[model samples]
Target chain A: MKTRQRILHYTGEVVLILFLVIFLIPLIQTFFTALKPDIEIYKTPVHIFPQHFSNVHYLHVFTRLSKDFISFFKNSVVITTVSVFLILGLGSLAAFSLARIDFVGKGFIIFFISLILSIPLIITVIPIFMMETAMGIKNSNLGLILPYTAVYLPIPLFIIYNNFLKVPTELEESAYMDGANRLQIFTKIFLPLIQGGLIAAAIITFLNCWGEFLFALILNTKRSATTLPIGIMMINDEEQSWALGPMSAVMILSIILPMSLYMIFQKNFVKGLMEGSVKG
Target chain B: MKSLKQGKKIRDNIVGWLFVLPAFVFLFSFMIYPISRTFILSFQKFNFVYDSKPVFVGLSNYVEALKTPSYLTALKNTLRFTLWYIPVIIVLGFLFGYIITLPKLFSSKLAKIVLFVPMVIPISMSCYMFLFILNPQWGLVNSFLANTIHLPMLVRDWMNDPRYALKIIIVVTVWQRIGFISLLFMSGIQGISSSIMEAAIIDGASAARRMWSIVLPNLKETFQIVGILAIITSIKLFAQVVAMTGALGPNSAGGPANSTLTLYVATWKAAFINFDMGVGSAMGYLMSLIIFLLFGLNFMLTKSERA
Candidate 1:
């Protein structure tokens, strides 16, 4: 019986290692291909390493596609950064009020947030596109920014609300007694207390906005407004193709942003992501 | 005293409104208004760039949408796609996550990094990466298969063939998503106390027995999270399909024969391509209703647990 168990364990570990390799090879290969010269991209019996390793792809994108690249990159960065900023700023206040303040029908309002967050925005794309077109933001960055912020609002709001609820209101009450204004109390105490939750919320908000594709694809048709993902896809087809090298290089950098952000707050990001999922 | 209390309540209400006002403006402008107008447009069959005004006809647009073979195909394809996708993502994520947590090895950390790399790369990046990798000629997949396994181009023109296009979408989606889901599961597994596993081991129970009886049960809560993510991600499945097979799948409306176009993608064309806002709106609403019920049940059940 012990021998049989040992055999099973060895088999499982072996299989697991094989599966992990299979899963990661494509990604690793893509990174390797990024260093290959553009012309060598489709070479058969593909070389695992680039024959003539080139930084040209990286340099080309930075130098040649600089304006378009920088603008689109900025579009993603500014929208993601600011939306998260406002979402946290407003979300914390709103979450605080809901968690602490006595109000009529608080349960229903909180319930609404839950419902809103769960409903996938895919069903509402038609209406959203129409609204954007009408607002003259159909192919504009604002169109992308506005809806992305609204649709994702429930998440940060929910996190902040739940985290706030866990904080002992006794502290806030004590602050109230000590003559700290509500603003002062929030800025100095509550803000510092929920910093982890806030960071997690911000990271998620940023990732969602940055990785957003569908809305960007539909709303931002012009080169000026399109995101890196959409831009990459558009350049994928046809001659003068951005080539596999630069494409993958840009993709690698794009990935680094979210990867680093996620790593910076891995625990909080994961915890916050799973917040609404696990409790039930 | 009554007036003062009412005034303070009003002030709080104002503050509340102010707080949500930014999100509200976005919701009203983008969601409510567009949805309402789109719903109205669906009732009117407007030809794109040709018809100035859509003629108001009730339910005809839906009838038209349903009658089209492509619509039926899209429904079937999406169902089939989900059937293939959900299981792989769920099983692979859970299985790989379990293995990754085994007594830390020399390469476990490096494996984790590589496993997660695919996730951070945007869907567009994956789409392009896979395109080069999966190309029928001189593509990495075919070459690797030919040289290593010697399969003699088991797949050629994958995107152009209806049969294979869906597979490509499913494969890419699974690959792109598996990493993230696995990482999520790894964390879920970590949340379980090791003492229980250690306890089971000390008692001389087999690893399989312990996993089936103990670890699986503890991971149920996390499984629920994965379940919701899977369902939500499944319905909104767009980028992978669009990126892989082009505008609508290559052969058909979704293509290789309407094989890759999902409900969301279909709704997209109906609005943007066909300019039939009403039908698109109705489709969107129908989709939302369907997804809402699914998500709502899960949400309520989760909430009820809280109660």
Candidate 2:
């Protein structure tokens, strides 16, 4: 029986390793293709490994292919940063109230947030586009920022609210006994305890804002405000589509921040997602 | 003394509303207002191309969408995609979830991270990578088939081929999402009581029997959640189709005979490309209605099961 258990364990390990390798093939291929010389990229029976590696694609992507690439990257950074900040601030405040404070209509507010969560973005984008146009906010960073904050708020709110529930009520009571107001208690006591939750919420919000394509595409048609994903899509224009190496280079560049965030704060990301999923 | 207590309760109510006010304002402006506006727009005749003012048209847009072949095809394709996508994700999610949680697997952490890598990367970037890997002339699949395996006859342009385009889009989306779904399942499996599992093991149940009798039954709520999420996501399939098929141009998103056209893509094309706001809003409204019904139905079924 011991031997049989050992055999089962070994088999599970082998299957897992094999699946991991197969799963990473696309990502590996993207990296390899990005490094290969342009001529090799066009060669038949595409090489999985670059015979002669080159940095030309990276250079071209940053310098020649898309002159506005830096601006796009900057837009992505600024927009994602600002959106995450707003989401965390507003989400935590609301979450704190819902979780701790007893008020009339509290249950209705929770129900309303969940209901809004169910409304998919595709249904809402057209009117948003029109509204942005009418208000002359189209082709600006604020246009995407406002909608993104609204759309992505529910998940973080719930995650933070759950986090708030886990904090001991004694902390709040003690703070109140010390003559601390509600605001002071929130900032001084509860906030420190829920740091992990805040990080989780922040990471999820950052990833969503960074990767959002549709809103960025429709709202920011101008080069001045286009984010990374839309900028990458723009590389598919008639002239640049054939430049596979440069395109792959651009793809790699776009994913670096998200990949690193996932690598470092993986546990927080998983926690946030699992919490949201169970509630969902 | 009672009046002071009452005053404190009123203050608490005021504070609670103040805290929620900012988020409420944003949700109201972006979500509630836009949704109502779309509903109203669906019933009007507004075409940007004609430079015409909005005119109230009663249900004509919805009637025309039902009659339109392309819109109908888009709806059919979305349903078909959802039918194919949900089961594959569920089965694979369970398999991977179970495997990664196996005892003494030192590589479980590595496996989980690798599996979840795709979820963090943007969907459009992944779709573009698949686009390159499936290119007919120099793509990995065709090249490997033709030159390495000598199966040249089997090679074809995948994304542009009507017979295979939708299937390719499904494959790409599944690849992007499988990791996320698997991780969700993994958490569900982990949430199962260890004592129960140990008891089954002591009872001499084989691995397959343990999984079938114990794990599967315990994962009911997880299944419901995953199913609802999968259905909603599949219905909102826009990015994959757009990024994969729109390589030529934005207008070609649902191309090669529109075999891959989804409701979202069709709505996008109608409003943005054809400048037909009424038709697009109508399609969007219908799609949302379907989504809400499915979501509500899933909840009802789960509630009944619990009872």
Candidate 3:
């Protein structure tokens, strides 16, 4: 029986390691493919590992598709960075207000957001698209940014609220007694206290904005306004023969910024992510 | 003091709204406003190809969408894929999370990073990866079956068959999303204490027994969270499909007898490719209604279960 239990434990470990390898292979394939030259991509039974890789594709992507690639990269970076900042800044205050301040309609507002957050995003898609087209901003960066914020709002706010609820009411009362106004109290005391939660929220919001696909695709058809995902997809969609290498390069390019940003803050990434997931 | 407090409260409210103003305006403009317009636009007939004036046509657009055979087909495919995708993502993801929690076995951190990487990559990229792997022309899998499996015909065009195409679409999309759901389940699982499981184990139960009897019962919260995210993300399974199909859309019957055409892709083609914004908007509205009905019961079930 003791030997049987040890065998089960060993079996579990081996299965997990194999599963881990399966998970990492795509990331590995990405880099391996990125390093390979264009000539190798079309070779039958395409080289899983190029015998000799050149940086030519990367340079080609940089120099040839540079203008289009960089612009889309810039667009994605700007939207993600700005939207993340807004989600954290706004999500913090609103969560605080929602959590601490007892006011009329607070329960309804909380309930509404909770309900809205739970539903699959299809509910608002039609309304948002119609609204954007009517306002004549359907194809602009504003179009992508707006929807991304709304979609990401609930999770961050939930994070902040959860963290806030854990703090004792005395913290707020102490600040009040110190003659600090409510805004100052919130900005100075509560905000700083929830810094870990805020970092988690900001990192998550940024990731969401960075990865957003649907709105970015539909709202920005024009090349100049294109975000990275659309740019990569659009290039492949153009039916160019040498589409694979350049498209892969673009795919790598678009995801690198977000991926690196994620890697840097990966610890917070899981924490923020896991919190958001269980709530909804 | 009372008046002073009132004035201070007013100021706080002002500052608070000011902070939240950007997010509110952004959501209002893009989310709230566009949704409102789509509701109204679904009633208007617009010739997208000719760029004609959109005339308000009441329920006629909805009626038109309902009459179309493809609308039903896309709806059927969407539900089928959702059904296929959600159950596996939720169940396997939960199981993986449960296994990782067993005695802290060999560090879940590395496992999580590797697992969730696909969730972050461009959908187009993963689409390409799967496309290459499943390609019939000396593709990796085809080559494998030809040599090892010893049947050249068994290396079928995975993406070209109607019956197989939808399943491939469902599988590909589910693969991209499973990592994130698993990570989520892990986090939620972590929040659950091991004492309950310890009690069960001490009671002489097997791990599966512990999982079913104690772990799973405690994991209801995680289940709810993963359930919602899975169903929700599965709705926008478009860019990847379009990438796979070469974007001819309904123009070429969406390939393999149009079996892979999702509601989003169909609606997109209706507006842009077919150039019928009326039908497109109608497609969007109808799709939303269908998603609501299918997921609504699950949502309410989870909600009521929580209460």
Which regions of candidate 3 fall more than 4 Å away from where they truly are?
A1-8, A115-139, A237-241, B1-19, B47-56, B147-151, B191-193, B247-254, B294-307
Model 3: how far residue A78 lies from native, Å: 2.1
- List CA RMSD, all candidates: 3.8, 1.8, 3.3
Tens-digit lDDT track of model 1 for B171-191: 888887776788778887888
Fnat across every predicted model, in order: 0.43, 0.75, 0.36
Docking class of 2: medium
Q: Using DockQ as the measure, name the better of candidate 1 and candidate 2.
A: 2
Worst 10 residues of 1 chain B by lDDT: B247-256
Query: What would the per-residue lDDT of candidate 3 be over residues B151-234, giving only the tens digit for each residue?
Result: 777878898888788787777777787777777677677777878767877889996787677767777877766665666666
The Cα error of candidate 2 at residue A274, in Å, is 1.1
Q: Clashes per prediction?
A: 12, 0, 6
- Candidate 2 clashes between residue pairs 3 or more apart in a chain or in different chains: none
Locate the minimum summed-lDDT window of 10 residues in model 1 chain A. A271-280
Q: Write the per-residue lDDT of candidate 3 for residues A1-280, one digit (tens) a residue.
A: 9999889777877887887775555455556666777677656655467788877768878887888888888888888887887688778878887777755556656766665664435436655655577789877777777778788888898888888887899989988888987679778889989788888888777767776766776678788888876666666656463265666566777777768867877777777776665455
> If scored against the real structure, what TM-score would every candidate get?
0.87, 0.96, 0.88
Query: Number of the top candidate by TM-score?
Result: 2
Model 3, residue B63: C-alpha shift (Å): 1.7
